[model samples]
Target: MCRSKIFRICLLFSAGYPLFQMTLRLIERTFYYPVSEPVDTFTILDLMFLGIVLAAFVSLYLGREYSDGVIRNKLIIGHSRMSIYLANLLTVTLGAFLMHGIFFLAMFLLGRLYGLPMELGFGELAPAALLGFLFIIAYASIFTMVSMLTASGSVGPVVALIIAFFLMIMGISIYSALSDMYAEIPPELLADPGFNPLASRPKWQQVLFPLLYNALPSSQAMQLMDYVAYAGAAKAGHLSTVVIEPTVFPLLAGTSALYDLLIATFTTAIGILLFRRKDLN
Candidate 1:
């Protein structure tokens, strides 16, 4: 756990934060006609940026040790394999959270400059924060497992990043499909015989959508982003635009956190068990 390296990564994240916002602002100024809406600071795009940064940093940080045989030296000295893995897991998890914080700090500051409202109230945002935190831990656990499994410096991070982006894409697609189910069908549309497509779906599909959404970390992040956007609107005194049910927040947050914890625990346990028996050579 080298503090200096972590600090350097954080500094890079801090720099990227403003660059991201500036890009969005530039888009609003140059492309969006009449600047239709405030730039959504709390969004799925945040996940993309943070995910790539953390994935690359964690992979390189751990991969270097494998390339240099530092892990083998640690094993020979007396340090338990479990401890080494856990330390790396903790380091990456904390680093992910720190990067998120730096981005949010920039978000709030940037929002103020544009006269944009805050994206979430304390009450509404708490559950999202908790869910996102669990997700970070889960991500760290899986990435750490991949890093430990691969011997090459270049392969681990690339694989982890690919997996991260793939999961995020899947989550977003699932959420969008489910969102169609939740949408209220207009009476005129329902009256059309050909428009009964949604009604024709099996009962099990309806039952499975929320369960699947709550189980995926990326879906949870997406849901949280949506809620934050609504909350931001409400905070800005446009409460009428907020359409999501109040109960949905607690349910999604609770289930997502539970799922993330289970994943983190399972991945860590498996990683530790495997690395213990792995030949360092």
Candidate 2:
């Protein structure tokens, strides 16, 4: 069953990988790709990374749920439900890491083909890989929780993708509101560099929205890619910021890691609890 799951996953990504890579390469050559503009918006990395992450995540969690015929045959002399859930989580996380490994390999090869320098210290690369894997794993767990309410493998990823889409829309809406209110400043209001754009309320405003408006995993992935973009640009002797609409208090990738860990705990615990009550015929 485990081997079947891995095989299916590899097959799915194998078909999808070439198209995404080709598109990215085309975009890079045209120089009309993501992050080329002055206005901040989702970059190509955002879509590619998120698409890969979401696909891998949904495949792993939901795939595991249905792939194991024996596991679903809970009527047999069964193992502990708690053990089942933990096993699923562990398996899903391992799947996420494996998927991430594939993604990074593809990305690095593409980077090399495009003549981009792909150098990084082993220490830096290790943590980055760990962070990316964790992000995907957490995201998969959340979607797995969603799948518990439904019965289809397709349902889990479709719902997650839709929800993720809407999350991006919501972020855009918030960004639009922020832009209209701030980007077009009065000449008298904007001449100073010390003006705080995101400072309407005190710094504590973050706490209020932390739950009200969560950042999408793609946007957060883009946040990391943006840094990679910046570092690449800076290496070329340019220090300009990437055109991602600045969050008044931009959540760095590390900060997103903190959020991922916290959110994963809640979502995964709930999923485990729900799995315990699963009525497998």
Candidate 3:
């Protein structure tokens, strides 16, 4: 995997993209916005691109291994199916982290040069960073599961990328619905007794939208970005226009992290079971 052309290209992207974004943002913040104080430099949303990148890389890597019969050769050499599955999971997860770490390093270095600090302190940042890492693991588990079960290396990437794209679209749709539903009403509308916002929506939508937003990895990523934005704003002693209530920030972050943990665990277990029964022929 390390020697593969795909791996090298991903590494370059992981590092270069963040640097490019940071530079653009810095220029924008300096010339267009012209803030007097340092601003928040990084957010979990910055790493969201990794979803598609990792999906493609993991699927293609596993596909190459499958085509070359490396998986079968490992079994022939006495490695158990479970061991092989876990090994792949670990490798892919590590690769994802390496990419994430590179982005972080690039962002941090650039932010420092531009005199922009992360705004949120260590205590505030740690949990968000940890949750972001968990999201990465969840992404790896999902793509690894899809690729490992697939017989054709070529087919694996297509399936994984489709799933990633679908999840992203679904997440965005849910988020937008929730945002519209919860958006603040005008004072006149609020005073009108007949204008209850919740009255128009079905009960199921009210419950399901929040549940899906917190549960899906892509939605969680979006939520984290909002959380980070709100936190940065609050830490800077400014009013946050972000719709998420600051009081529920901890609750949302905790719930999102829990979902990520559950996703990674569930996907890995199911992948192992399915791979054990998969025929190499």
lDDT of 1 by residue, 120-169 (tens): 54455545554567778777888888898886688998898997887777
lDDT of 3: 0.77
For model 1, where is the 10-residue window of minimal lDDT? 239-248
lDDT of 2 by residue, 1-281 (tens): 34665545664674357447655655765676543332111112323345445644665455556645556665366778777666666766666556566655555455545544443433434444455665675576676667554545666667767766665565555544444655556545554568654466456654443332335555555455555556445545766533333322234555766777776788878877877777764
lDDT of 1 at 241: 29
Model 3: pairs clashing at backbone N, Cα or C within 3 Å:
63-153
Instruction: Please name the candidate that would achieve the greatest TM-score relative to the true structure.
Output: 3
Residue runs of model 3 more than 4 Å from their true location after superposition: 29-33, 36-43, 121-123, 184-200, 246-249
Write model 3 residue lDDT over 116-195, tens digit each, in one string: 65677656665776667878888999999999998678899999999999988899898777677657654456445576
lDDT computed for candidate 2: 0.54
TM per candidate? 0.80, 0.68, 0.87
Error of 3 at 134 (Å): 0.9
What's the lDDT for residue 110 in model 3?
74
Error of 3 at 175 (Å): 0.8
- Give the lDDT of residue 12 in candidate 1: 75
Q: What C-alpha lDDT do the candidate models reach, one value each? A: 0.69, 0.54, 0.77
Task: Flag clash pairs in model 2.
Answer: 40-243, 40-245
Alpha carbon deviation, residue 88, candidate 3 (Å): 0.2
